[model samples]
Target: MNGLGYEKMEKYYLTNLNDLLLCMKKAINFINPEIEYHHQQVAYLSYKIGIQMGMLEEELKDLLIAAMLHDVGSIAFGEELEILNEGDRANAHAYAAYKLLEKFNQFAYVASIIKYHHLPWNHGSGRSFDNERVMDQSHIINLADKVVVRLNRNKPIINQVNRIKHYVSNNKGSLFADRVVDAFMEISEKESLWLYLAYYPDSINDIMEYILRDNRLTVDDVVSLTDIFARIIDFRSPFTAMHSAGVAAAAVEIARHAGFSSNECKMMKIAGNLHDLGKLKTPKEILEKNSSLSEEEYNIMKEHSFYTYMALKDVSGFEEITKWAAFHHEKMNGNGYPFHLKAEMLPIGARVMAVADIFTAITEDRPYRKGMAKNDALKVIIDKTNDGDISKYISTILIKYFDEVVSMREKAADKAIKTYKSFTEQMKISQEDVFAMVAEKSES
Candidate 1:
């Protein structure tokens, strides 16, 4: 290992922790544009409150990450909006988020916060695990979450402040910790706070930069973090469980054949893994459809790449990765989606990614059909090349090394599948169990 604790021979890519968190928040919220800034609002409120409560900087950092990702579990259910609005139904997602995060040692504390984000503050008795009290930070998140849900962005901040205060005040002792409530009450007194929350979406990013300015993550750390999100993006549907992994593997192989430097290859692999980050917003029904999609469904699918671009475009170190990943669907003739750049405008990395994407899709099984035979898949790709959709050179390379590329894709996908199963199987409580608890709680 080198000074960064990554393998010495491998090239590492680094990104700002706050920038990465913002990208992830955007990707997660892309599930519904109506709720695109919901996580940010919650995180912003939680951070303001944490500052008022005089939390240690490290504690605030943890709280900020937990708050931003608190609702990630809701993605597992089809009725995500319903799950978020209905207190009873939402707990399942919270538990899901907890199970998902706890598996990573670095995120265990954040997992604990997410696990009980919905739990009320009727003292320590309201939520416990193995007879331990839920962390106080969870209560702060709960308060921030509830406050944001009540906000009506269309209304003026002054018009909504009294109503919001009333709601929080009424639930203060029973639903939120007294200290947390006091902190919120202190911060809520400022008119600027409400203005920031209700009107200024960009301010959240500014706050995050101020808060995380001193902390820097190495390239290896960012890669590990992106890997977590890659799982979240692909694991949303079984048909796509290994899609990103396969693309990353194939892209790396193609880049190697194209004689990309080691660092460039590594960056290409990361881009390929995250190329589908916007798919998190695509509905599962659309993704799992066995037959060809209607034009409307296909249109929705095309937006995934656009969404990927929007999410990653702002990350300081991801300019190349963003273009490579988001431009995969673009064609040489300028017939691609979200953006319509012609061959002269497209970069080599983007062209390689486009080829890798098509190759992986044809070889991978979908919910409705079996994967194509090698010769047949190759023919389809060659036909596309002839039609000016992708690069003929890359297509030729894939065909020449078909078996080796396929083997690499398969190995990478298998490892991804194992990781997915491990995450699902390690959860001690099932979604059904969470549903039962919600039902039991509702009855009482």
Candidate 2:
């Protein structure tokens, strides 16, 4: 890595512990502005409860950090299910949240909270390995999160307050920790806390700064945020979990062997991760289908690249990066969909993305088919070279490094499912909590 590349990576992921927290803060703000530093409320409530129960400052900060990332999975859920009815929304949000956080070992505990945020505490009673720390904070975040959701949506104030009270009462030992309920009950009695916690103006940047100050996030934090965003694209479909990562790995390796500048290769990595953001709009069934697709379904699949390009086309700092991500589908002869970008219009980085995309697809196992072996996969690419689709020169370099590229395809395929076992245990919270919270709010 060049000095500049090293600097960017350090700023985001490899950093001092203080820097990581700061990054998390900024990421939360960018990804969920509507919540408007609502993570701070979760942090505040979690800290206060931790303190009331005599936990140390360091422990409280850990809880606070976890709270900031609590709803991060929601970003992974994308735009479609985010608009679903209340019950589906809860499940979608919590599942998406868990899948996103579980990638980093540092935040696995926090991921547990996001997973179980909607579950009742007692749901795991039969399991000997049930985690106690996660149970407590999950309840705390769920309660705090509900208050924010209701208030922001302009739900009746008195009703929201009573709902909080009743939710705690109904699932004391089952969905919530007994002590957590005690603390929430005390806090619910103070009406002003809810008002202060929920209030926010229209500006997203304002909320971003608020979260940064409270959590100490910094610009370097965007690295984690970027990874989170990349994961979001894959999470929209089970077939795509490692899609970006594989594309990135393959593109970077091919770039190196092909003698591209280090800067160009770095850009390639970012492009590979973002190339499929448009796939978030495609229905999961269409993307995962094994049999021949209907023309209608095939037509929907083609729109994903267009959606990706449009979404990032206006985002600053993504000028060059967006091309590689969105142009991968374009053919050298100008027969591609979306923009139908021609060969001369396509940049070297985009060409690399196209190569990486094709190589990864053939080598990785699909829902209906086992992975094509490396030699067989290479033969397919070579045939494309003969057809004048993929360039002969770049195809040669890619096939030369086929061993490395196939390894990436293997690694990525393994992680494509977006499955989190721990979260399944936590999903139970939402079933009971939603029913209880709604009924309680109705009665009050």
The alpha-carbon lDDT assigned to residue 283 of candidate 2 equals 67
Off by over 4 Å in 1: 1-13, 76-83, 99-108, 126-128, 131-133, 152-173, 188-192, 281-285, 296-300, 332-344, 418-444
For candidate 2, write residues 1-444 as lDDT tens digits.
Answer: 233353345334322334334433443344445443666666555655665666655555556666666666565554454521245456557656766766655567767766666554454441222344454566666555554555543654655777657765886666556777787677667666566554532232343334334443223333344566666666555566567777878887887777766656666776777788677667668877878899999998898888778765654455777788889888787778778777899877788888899988877766567778877887899888777677666788887777877776566555544342234345456445455544433222
Residue lDDT tens for model 1, 231-341: 778878778888998999999898888877666777788898799998888878888887889999999988899988998999887878899999999999899987899
Q: Report the number of the highest-lDDT candidate.
A: 1
TM-score of each: 0.84, 0.63
TM-score of 1: 0.84
